[model samples]
Target: MADGLARVREQIAAASARVGRTPEDVRLIAACKTFDADTVREAIGCEQMVFGENYVQEAKVKWPDLKDEYPHTELHLIGPLQTNKAREAVALFDAIHSLDRHSLAKALSRQCENQERHPVMFVQVNTGEERQKSGVLPGEADDFIAACRNLYGLNVAGLMCIPPAGQPPEQHFDLLAKIAARNGLSELSMGMSSDYATAVAYGATNVRVGSAIFGNRFYPPAGQ
Candidate 1:
């Protein structure tokens, strides 16, 4: 685990240096989805404090005790979020990377009011316009971001994106960075384990990496 982290950090530094940016310019989000609590503890032991999870329920099960033990660790939701889970999500995640719709924005807004806990939000843009993805289409991002702020009062801190699979990711990363720049957002979360180096070149403020640090994920046998 330590070796994996070291290699990823080295890649980050090399990429950042290529563009005259320091590694500190980018935040590494260790994607911990599908991994158990014990495995996550090993990551914490390696001083990898920031993490990202996909589901609210899974995080609810594993993170409470972990967070209590490692109070400095930050957790983020980096996958599709259901409106029904808004309350628990607002409470559990330190940040959310999937604020992609007005309905979800409204739900999260209400949950924030109810819980008095406002998690940092990133508007996910479907740069590739894929039909099966969760992000707002790229063209609608401006209005959606405005609505999230003006209508719902959610602090729109940044933007997130997942480039279409098998496409040149840099183009999508460029699009995300441009939208963020025009919107006065400085944080861009648009990288993953596979292409984080290229993402850094295009000014990604945060990168979500999992397999690179932890190796391939092992899913339970169906119906276990």
Candidate 2:
């Protein structure tokens, strides 16, 4: 585990250097989906303060237990959030990276209002235009950003995206950076375990990584 974190640190340093940006400028969000608490604790010991989770239920189970142990750690919701779970998400996560639609945004806003926690949010953009992905199409990004800005209890901090698999992820990162720039947006949340370095070069403020850092996930049987 120490060796893995050391290697990840080296990669982050090199990647930051390649892009002429300080390593501190790029925040590494350790995607802890399916990883156990001990593994997350190990990451915390390695000084990884930001953790990303995919599911509300899984996070609800994990975060409460971990937060007491790692008080300074920040939790980010990096999955497609459902409207029904917005209240819990607002109460638990420090930031949400998968806010894609107006209805979800509105629900989150109301939830935030009730909780009195202004959670940072990102508008997910479907850079690859994948029909199955949960993000706004490129053409509609402007309107979405505008709508998010008007939401009272949410902070429209940036943009997030997941590029198509097997394709050069740089293309998607470049598109996201361009769109964010045109829209006067500052934050770009793109990239993952395999393509995070490319994302940094293209302008990713936050990178979500899982397998590379924590190794493969272990899932139970469907009935479990």
Candidate 3:
């Protein structure tokens, strides 16, 4: 685990430097979704304090205790968010990288009102316009972001995206960067383990990585 983290960090630095950008420009969010608290503790020992989780329930079980032990550690939600989970998400994550809809923006706003904290938000965009994905279509992102800002009054930070499988990811990254700039947004959550180096070369403020850091996710045998 230690070696894995050190390697990833070094690679991130190299990737950033390839484009004359400092490694400090890109924030690595170790995607530790199915891993246990012990896995995260190992990462913390490695001084990798930021992580991304896919499920709200899974994160709830692990992060609070980990945060209590390492208060500086930060967690992000990198999965599709249901409006119903807004409050729980607001309480658990420091930032959310999947704010994809007006309905969710409204839900998060209400939750923010009650909690008095607004988690940083990244409007997820389905750059390829894939039918099966969770993000807003590229055509609608501008209006959606505007609504998230003016109507919901949520802290709309930037944009996030997942390029279609087997496609060149550079264009997707470029498109997201342009959209973010047009909105005067600063953050870009647009990469995963496979293409994080490419993402850094572009303009990704955050990368959600998992397998490269912790190896493959192991699941129980069927019917366990």
**TM-score for each prediction?**
0.98, 0.96, 0.97
C-alpha RMSD of candidate 3: 0.9
Per-residue alpha-carbon lDDT of candidate 3 for residues 32-93, written as tens digits (9 for 90 to 100)? 98799998998888889899999999998888889899999988999999999998999999
Using lDDT as the yardstick, the better of models 2 and 3 is 3
Q: How accurate is candidate 2 locally (lDDT)?
A: 0.89
**Greater-TM-score candidate between 1 and 2:** 1
Query: Residue 93 of model 2: what lDDT?
Result: 95
Off by over 4 Å in 1: none
Please report, in order, the local distance difference test score of every candidate based on alpha carbons.
Answer: 0.95, 0.89, 0.92
Count of backbone collisions in candidate 2: 0
In terms of lDDT, the poorest run of 10 residues in model 3 is: 1-10
Best by TM-score: 1
Q: What is the clash count for each candidate, in the order shown?
A: 0, 0, 0
**Stretches > 4 Å off in candidate 2:** 151-153
